[model samples]
Every structure is written in C-alpha cells, then in structure tokens.
Target: MNFYLDVDRTIITKEHREALELNDFLKYLFNTGEVYWLTTHCRYEDTSSVLSYIMPFLTLENYDLIKNIFPTTWNTLKTEAINFSQPFYWFDDYLLEVEKRILLENRCLEKWIKIDLDKNGNNIMRAAKSHNPNLFSSI
Candidate 1:
C-alpha cells in the first residue's frame, strides 16, 4: 500500500516537541517497506528546508525512496488519485478534512485510509506488536 504524506508541519518541525513513538512509527513505515509512497503539497522551499533538517535521522535508502514526492495542488491531486488502488493512506494535519470530503464524494476510494497528525494509540504498530514473541506483558 502507498502512504501519501503532506510535508510541511507534519513530519518535519523545528520548534516545540514531537512524539518519539510517532517519529519511530514513521521511520518504521519507510524502513520496513510498509508504505509505498509519501507525498506532499507544500512549496519547494519549505520542503527543501524540512528535508535538510530531517536528513540526519533518515537513512540513505529512505532519502532515495522518497523520490515519489509529487508537486501537487490540493484540489487537483484528488482527481489524479481517483482510479488508484493499493490501500493508500493520506497523512497530514492539513489534509484531514479534505480527505474526509473526498471519501464522501468518491465511493471508489472508500477503502483508502486517512491517518491523523497524531500516530499512536492502537494502530499499525499495535497490530504488529501483537505478533511479537518476546512481548512478556499483555500489551
């Protein structure tokens, strides 16, 4: 499945604090090949600046796979995504409402997922953890 993410104010940040679990979740998604794509609608300058800031933590492979980044406008990208399959996920604080609207309008995309800006509490990570043999407690 492909995971499409909005760049600015989502993954990259400078001020305040970010959740370590959420950060680890993202790194797992990219490193484990669980997500097929990551996208953004932000301007080039903002994307560039964020990428520079995040470069230290991301591996070279992740930097390469992120080539799927598309320069898309918010309204227009919806139409392009209409016919696509593969359990696509849209991750961004900016896209939550839009994703809901699109899901309502486009019946074909009902299977797609809209991930919140917060990425914890009973999600893919928990699902994966369920299968772990080393987990001692009832997690």
Candidate 2:
C-alpha cells in the first residue's frame, strides 16, 4: 500500500513536540509500503522546505529514511495528488471538507487516518507497536 504522510500535528504533536515513536512508525511504513509527502510544506514537488522543517525532530537515521519519501504536488486539494487506483492510506491531523468529499466519492474515506495528537498523545507509539496493517484500528 502507498502511505501518504502529513506533518504538523500528525507526526509532530499539537504540543509542538515530535511523537516519541515517530522513527519506529516511519520505519514500519517505509518497510511495509511506499511513503510520500502529502503536506503543504512539500507542494510544487519540492521537499527541501519540508525536510528542513522536520529535521530537528528526527534522528540521523530517520532523517535519512525520510529522504526516501517521494514528493507530491497538488494544485488545489491534497487529494489531487493521490492515485485513487491504488491501495493507500493518508495520515493527517485535519482534512478539508472538499478533500473528504473526494475520498468519499472514491470509496476510500476509511483510508484517511485522522491523527489528533491533542486527544491521543500516544497515537504514533500505538501504531508503531501494533505491527498490524490496520495500525490505527485500536486507537
């Protein structure tokens, strides 16, 4: 499966801290599927800004791992960059109403894993430890 990742409160917490298990979660995603940057920071097919923004929060190894994540460009909604024909999951803290409609129309609304760090602080940790394809099922 392809995994689309967002930054901000999804990987980084609402408290402005990096998730404790971020590296592990990233490792799992990288090992299990293709991962891509699906955040505003990486728009226009440029990843430098996003990489710099996330640098301080990652370990050296994870930083290297992150470099392998492909970049995505979307003119409007992030959903524009998504390949609906493939199996994938999108991890994000927030979703636009229009984007939700796109997912619903594609019959893949369940693939969007909403990560609210404010309420579930251990989300990344739980996902990393779960070792299941449905990482957030028990969250």
List TM-score per model, in order.
0.44, 0.87
Tens digit per residue, CA lDDT, model 2, 1-139: 8999998887887665677778878877888889999999998889999999988876787789899999998988999999999999888878999999999999999888877666655467564333345564433
Q: What lDDT score is found at residue 65 in candidate 2?
A: 89
Q: What's the C-alpha lDDT at position 86 in model 2?
A: 91
Model 1, residue 84: C-alpha shift (Å): 3.3
For candidate 1, what is the TM-score?
0.44
lDDT for model 1: 0.44
Candidate models: Cα lDDT each: 0.44, 0.82
Candidate 1 lDDT, tens digit per residue, 1-139? 4555544334433232332344455665565334432344343323554455455654555455454344333334543443355444455435446655776676634334333334433243442233332221321
Q: Which regions in candidate 1 have their CA more than 4 angstroms from the true location? A: 13-19, 31-50, 53-83, 96-99, 107-139
RMSD of 1: 7.4
